[model samples]
Target: MVRMFVNGQAMSGGSIHAPLTDARFLGRAWTAPRYRFWSFRDEFPGLEPVSTDGWSVPGELYAVSYAVLRERLLPLEPPELELAVIELADGSGSLSMRVRAEALAGAVEIRHPDGWHGHLATRQPG
Candidate 1:
């Protein structure tokens, strides 16, 4: 099984969390403090590597079998999101998804590393 850090709707109780149903939860994790985050219309979020400075995004880590990642998760992901190699706080590389550069051209940089969760928490019912 491979580890993936999910910081968006794939977390427990999130909208698109169905794909992780069979995956094993590995508790909470955070990224290295050198990445930026962006929100895509609040439906989901994206992460980008920033050399200068950034925050350590908080999220849930999961250990999923190779087949689940390659077949299920990847297939259900949106076009704007892509599997990315990220450096976790533990100094290891993991596969996750982030927004494409083109899609983030004018997107807002989430001020807080854990902004995604915070944003969603404050959302009102439509």
Candidate 2:
């Protein structure tokens, strides 16, 4: 099982876990969009589409949108709260990661072979 930590505190089990297997992280960067938008033209007829700029959505709506969008694009689960890139040690090899939600801000422990261990910290956002 994987253990999760947030801001240096250990979170309980059952948090979503997504392995970073794809090589997309090789050159890509995570830039929180200055604006996030969704169109409603198709869903609501006769009503003009609505657009929201900036990160000012209500807490519930924001949470729902975060969950939907993250799941649609990646393997992230709900309530994790942010994004981070991590590297884990597994036996003779290591695994690199790009995770979402509260799992973003901290270091993770990776147990190594021969009873050794390693810790990887999340990268700072620009």
Candidate 3:
């Protein structure tokens, strides 16, 4: 299983089984519209079981324009950060993500179709 140490906590997903240093663990981007979010999970079937263990969180999907995606995530990433493209499982397209060295901390703001915004934070260990 691929293990990612996000904020010192270990997160393993089926799609990632190699060491953290593996290139695969680098920036992996995935994008799905508000409609076909399930396809994202389907692409990496192996990750399903692991994804449920701790990484699973109820998150609503939003359709973000490519310009907005670049404006939000790319600018915040460090210079050394790697870029990965996560293609929406539903075949819509892909989103860009920057893999950081630090543990997965902070919250992600997702905008729903109805103009509602939700913030999701990483699961904290007890």
Candidate 4:
């Protein structure tokens, strides 16, 4: 099975998350401390690797089979998102979704505490 890291609406209790339900949840994980994060119109998060100092973005990991990866997950993903190898905190790598440069234009920078969950919290209505 190929493991993939999910950092946006495909996460638990999120929109468009059903595709991952049958996959094995590998619990929470973080990226290497060199990535930038953004919320694209509050619809989803987009992460990119940067050379400057950055914090690890928190997210979930899953073990998906090749059929699911090629046939379902990849196809269901937004056009702006692409599959790329991501460096994890555990000194390992997993296939992750990275945002293309075009998608991040005019996006809201998710600085400090790089986590989608934290960003989502700020958007909740009290």
Q: What is the clash count for each candidate, in the order shown?
A: 0, 6, 12, 0
* lDDT (Cα, tens digit) per residue for candidate 4, span 60-82: 99999989888877787888788
lDDT of 4: 0.85
Model 2, residue 34: distance off in Å is 2.6
- Sort the predicted structures by TM-score, highest score first: 4, 1, 3, 2
> Candidate 3 — worst ten consecutive residues by lDDT sum?
38-47
Q: Give the alpha-carbon lDDT of every model.
A: 0.84, 0.21, 0.27, 0.85
**Judged by lDDT relative to the true structure, which candidate is superior, 3 or 4?**
4
Residue 95, candidate 4: C-alpha displacement in angstroms: 0.5
Over 4 Å off, model 1: none
Lowest lDDT sum, 10 consecutive residues, model 1, at 106-115
Residue 49 displacement in candidate 1 (angstroms): 0.7
Q: What would the per-residue lDDT of candidate 2 be over residues 16-43, giving only the tens digit for each residue? A: 2122221122221111212221211111
Query: Distance (Å) between predicted and true CA of 100, model 4?
Result: 0.6
Candidate 4 runs further than 4 Å off: 112-114
